[model samples]
Target chain A: MKSILRLSVNGKPREDAVADNTLLIDYLRDALGLTGTKQGCDGGECGACTVLVDSRPRLACSTLAHSVAGSEIETIEGLSHAGNLSRLQRAFHEHLGTQCGFCTPGMIMAAEALLRSNPHPQRAQIKAALAGNLCRCTGYVKIIESVAAASATTELSA
Target chain B: MAALSDFRLLRPASAAEAVRLRGEYPASRFIAGGTDLLPNMRRGLVTADAVIDLGRIAELSELRVVDDRLHIGAGVTLATLAADPVARARLPALAQAAAAVAGPTHRAAATLGGNLCLDTRCMYYNQSEPWRDAIDNCMKIAGDTCRVATKSPRCWAAFSGDVAPALLVLGAEVQILGPQGMRNLPLSEFYRDDGMAWLSLAPGELLLSVRVPLADGWLSAYEKLQIRGAIDFPLTGVAVALRRTGDLIGELRIACTGVSSRPELIGGLDALAGKTLDDAALSGIDRQIRRGTQPMETTVISVAYRRRATPVLAKRLAKRLWAASA
Candidate 1:
């Protein structure tokens, strides 16, 4: 069975016929070619498939595409506006957050959702927000530093 | 990636419509959040010819206080519940338990109803089809003998949900809607000890909401032990809710999950009623909890570790509560 899915992905309107069993991750990566949203573990255990549904971080691998119709989805691919990297993305690059680069998209996406809601988050809040996104490399110190740095810069600019 | 079997998705807008769809598709399973159910289906642990999506039912996501009871809609996501000021103020244990669930992203999609109805998990039962096929499968999926205990005839898949134990301790009641009509039962009655048939709901019944009684003079705490800080199911989860009148205990409830086939309220705590929480009294209650709970070798951590740690955790929680009261 196929269902018509209407969603705003990365601020662009997308209407597609998705299978009944198609996961949000599969829809983003395979169907729409939004490969920036990585799929790791495929179960909800790892947040490698993290995406913003209605501006809240959700695991794409576990969410059914049909369930999230008419919602705005922000992904790692959408983080950059024009030719500029997002503040969080820049902080990640500056702090050496990406080691293997597999968990970067998800970590950044989760952090994006965090900073969207709480712009000036503390270090512990950043850790709690990125707790779902796991990075096997860097031992999470650099990733935490990256999110902290981004929050600090955002705090300063505001 | 494991492919889900071919199935028709049914999105029902209301509880009545959901019930009707469930009746029409008796073999179909309800999908909310799809965190636990979808993964199980992917692993071939569960399959359905039709999936009744409960996400579209807006009423199931309501969270409010009505008639002095906190009515938490079944579809209210774990993340929302954890961050809700009312939930933290009143049912703090439940809020903490919701936060203690698998990470931030899973909590965003995983609903309270989904967690309460989470599938009983066994290390042997949660593997991929090929992985289970290699082991000849366990009693939870296909094979007869219990993999946790070879001679046991029953499935020993442990109940790993973090929220159920907290709700059970809080004297919460579940509002269920079915073809027969709406009925409410204590959350304690909602669970069965059997792993395969863990929930006590009827075939077409859907959990609509959970009603948690106002914790007027009560202090509650929930502590979970897992291998990692995140993304892992609790090896042992302990939830305690109690009220004290000066030095004497008024009412007490101690509950635990990830220890047995079902999250259970440790009985005989009524024995501690009208008594002060001395070390001897606590040790006695701790011994009772340790004796009553039966942690099986069905999860990631060793059963020995879980068994030994349950009472220690309970005692520690009780001490913290006492300290707070003081």
Candidate 2:
């Protein structure tokens, strides 16, 4: 069953024919060619497929593409503007938040949602927001620092 | 990673239409958040000919008070429930339990109805299709023997959900819509001890909303024990609701999940009323919980650990609620 899904991706409205059973991650990675969103554990165990649906972080692998019709879906690729990395991405890069970079996109997306809502989040709040996302490489010290650094930079700019 | 099995998806606009579609496709299953169902479907633990998505139903997303009782629609997401001011002020246990489920992202999508109707999970049953096939499916699936308890005819899959215990302690009632009509059942009666048939919902029935009587002067709290603080299901989850009458116990209710096939309200607590929650009373309550809960080898955690920890967790919650009343 294929239906036209009308949604906003990366601030652009898209109306694509998607299968009823096609997961959001597949639709982004395969259909839209947004390979920035990596699929770590296809099952909902790992947060490698985290994306922001209507400004809230959701597991793309667990969500159906058609289910999020008329919503704003943002992937990791949406973060950069004019080829420059977003604040969180730059923080991750500078703070050594990525090793293999498998979980970086989902981690940054989850943190992106967190920082948007709570611009000055504490370490515990940052940790709580990204608890679902797992990073095998950084041991979370750099990841936490990355999020904290992004928020601190935001504070400095404000 | 395994792919999801092909199935038709139907989105209904209303609860009545959802029921009609369910009847139209008798082999269909209701999906609210798809957090639990999608994972299970991907693992081949469950399959439906069609999935009747309840996401678009407007009525199921409402959360309001009716006649002094909080009418929480089944479709209300856990994240919304956790952050709701009314839920936090009135039924803090439910809010805390909702916050405690899975992780922040999962809670953003998982619904109250789905959590209430979560499938019973077992170590052997929750595995991949190839893994389960290698050992021959368990009683929950197609096999003849129960994997957790080989000789037992019934499956021992534990109900590891975190929300049911909180609802049970609050004396909640569920509004169920079926082909016959609408009916209400006590939340306690909504579960069965049998793992394979945990929920008491009849075929073609949908849980509409949960009605919880507002606890005016009650101090409630929920505690969960899991391997991790997030994502993992509870090894033992306890919810305690207590109302004090000036240094004496006015009312005390305790409920637990992940200790058995169904989340249950701990029994034999009527004697504790009008008595101060002293050390002796707390110890007595601990004994009662230990006697009531029978943790099996359903999860990766040891039965002995769960059995020992259930009482400690329950007692800690009870004491905290009791102390908070002061």
Candidate 3:
């Protein structure tokens, strides 16, 4: 059975008639073409498929489309407006937080969620927040530094 | 779109609706975080006709502390528990277990209910069924006679649920809701100590809530021995909950996980009812802890290694408890 699912993805209200078993990642990748949410492991182990559902980063590959009805969705592509990189995105570039960038989208999205709520997070706090998103290339040091560097300025702003 | 077909999903708005839907579709299962379920499905260990998404059920996502008992709903995420100040301050062992489960992102989506219902794990058993068939199937999933315990009739796979020992030592109670209303009992009582029927929840019964008695003057600690400090399942895990009265130990509960078929609790702590946790007492406690564990050839860790490290963890836990109270 299929039902219509309505939600605002990346701040825009959208609706789609989804089948009973359609995953939210398929809706984002195949239907809406929001390919930024990578589907890695298709299970929840690798955070490569992470996307924000109601401001919390979740495994899009594992989340069903029908369950996200009426919730706010955010993807890595939505992090910036007017073609400008968000601060965390900029920090990733500055700190060399990417290698092949396979896990970049999920890592950045997870970091953005952390920075959104906690602008000034400690080193331990930053490490804790990004634990779900695994980065095989940078060994996590650059990723941690990117968040910490962003946090320094983020704290001063707030 | 002309009604897509991939995997069937149903979002039940309420608990009643979810249970009723579960009744209709015997092949359907509730989706809490999908960390465990989705992985098993992708690996083909589990194939479902339909999946009931439990996110819409508001009653399951609550965390309430009332009258010295903390009530945690099934939907409450590990991230929420790890980040909650009340949990850290009041239920330190649980918070430690929650923080250490998987990694941060998993802690965000993975719920208390999901962790509690984590599939019984083993390195040999977690592989694909086809992969198992190649090996003639281990005792856990497809075939009979535990290769882990080749002489054993029952599955020798581990009960590696991270929070089980933490909740067990804290005097936690599990709430089970079914068609007949609800029932609550000590969390330890919910275990069958058999890998096949690990959780005691009956058909159509949802593990609704966990009630942990508040520790006022009590000091607790949780320690896990794992290959990696982050994201790896514990080779052996320990949780210590104690109440010290002046120089005397008022009460104590020691529990361990990832060491047996279930969260193994070595009771009869009344012996240490008034004894102080000094160097001598800790050494004595370590000996008692060694007597408690009966490690087997299940998990990734060697039985000899886990058995050796069990008392070491007990000594560390004893010292931490001493310092926590100090």
Candidate 4:
């Protein structure tokens, strides 16, 4: 039941033979040794396993590894370039968005998708995009602030 | 943490081929987005020896308006359907319901077909396998007794799909393909009251598309009562469609979910025809809904709370539709 899967991960081509039931999160964390994507609440309820598949945010835990073959998959490990944090990541840190740090990776990915589609999203829009992700700590005040700050930074850069 | 059982994955090029593969492997399950099925598989609620992925089939992902009806392929993702211009302009109720399902990331992967045919859920039935086994199981699984209503002879798992009630209220029809051939039926006919056999889909049968007719001069609204704004199934879902002329009601259809095993299309609304939806008439409809629905003790909240919320949600949604039509 093992099939060869060929996909682009973190802007690099990856090919591996995987079981039919291999989840995308498992393939990323175990087979590829990219542990930046944390797995919490293996069910689709929690957004801890969020990843970008074909430039869209999706729950990695509920996604099958074989179904997304040949798609560009982005993970937390790919957020920084040349060892410097991405704009969204820097904004998250500066705004004190991480508390306990378990939900940061997924939170950033969800925001990344929102910002990619809407450069200067309003507060309600940012909240709607991150509605699926759960952060028990920080009470979501600073998380929203971080996304708003990231949008402002993008405007300045532009 | 649960893990999926071993299974062979099959990718068919077309719907006909998918049916053929399904016929060849009777124990296989068709997976489009895997948002609902995979988690159930992991929890040992659904057992399948093979998975037939419908994502690669191009024809099944089509969403178009033909003549006067909107034809949405079963494989169309919920996110795509919610954001489609035609759906938003023509079927706003369906668009809102689809947008309200699950969360943003799950909406990106969950398909309309899967949401329409979502599994029945219960507090006891949806638990992990070991947890269910420890409690001696329920009628949804292996046990003979119904935990929700100990003396009842059937399973009372709640059908919590947010999209089906809206589709039902819009007077939609489903296109089904199977080993016998293809046939189209009203969306209401596709559901059965029994939770164990909620869907009327035969073995090896595949749902092809959902066809919703465009109705002129009709306005609709949907409301869902749940604990969270996102990522939670509705405890009570209400949908109302009203066609009015000035202050008089021309046509009205009310439907609800999460109150029973299948979405209930409320009857007895014809009594208020040609009459304005006044406070008295609204209270009458609310009482009718309360008397008709039987909320079981299956979810986190108490049965009384869910039963009480049903009529409130219906009245609120009815008022919204009336205001919009006015």
Identify the candidate with maximal lDDT: 2
lDDT digits (tens) for residues B1-326 of candidate 3? 11223567877888888888888888878888877877677676666788888988898988988887998998999989877787799889999888888877777778999988888777778776667788788766667778787888887667777888889888899998887778997898888778778888888888888999986887777888888657777788888888888878888888887877787886656688788877777766676667766677777668999988876886788677876786
Candidate 2 residue lDDT tens string, B1-326: 57777788898999999999999998889999999999898888788889999999999999999999999999999999999998899999999999999999999999999999999988999988889899999999878899889999788899989999999999999999999999999999999999999999999999999999996888888989999879999999999999999999998999999998999899999889999988888888888898888889988889999998988888888888877889
lDDT for each candidate structure: 0.90, 0.91, 0.81, 0.91
Model 4 per-residue lDDT tens digits across residues B261-315:
9988888888888989899889888878986677898799999999888988888
Please give, for residues B89-136, the per-residue lDDT of candidate 1 as tens digits: 888899999999999888988999999999999888989888988988
DockQ of 1: 0.84
Across residues A2-90, which tens digit of lDDT does each residue of candidate 1 receive?
Answer: 97999999999988989988989999999999999998888888789899999999999998898899999989988887768889889
List, in order, the clash count of every candidate structure: 0, 0, 5, 0
Worst 10 residues of 2 chain A by lDDT: A149-158
Q: Any runs in candidate 4 off by more than 4 Å, and if so which?
A: A155-158
Which order, best to worst by DockQ?
Answer: 4, 1, 2, 3
Native contact fraction per model: 0.88, 0.76, 0.72, 0.95
Q: Model 4: clashing residue pairs? A: none
lDDT of 4 by residue, A42-124 (tens): 99998989999988999999999999999999999998887778888899899998889899999999999999999999999
- Model 3 misplaced regions, further than 4 Å: A152-158, B1-7, B278-280
lDDT of 2 at B254: 94
**Residue B101 miss distance in model 3 (angstroms):** 1.3
Q: Worst ten-residue run, lDDT, model 1 chain A?
A: A149-158
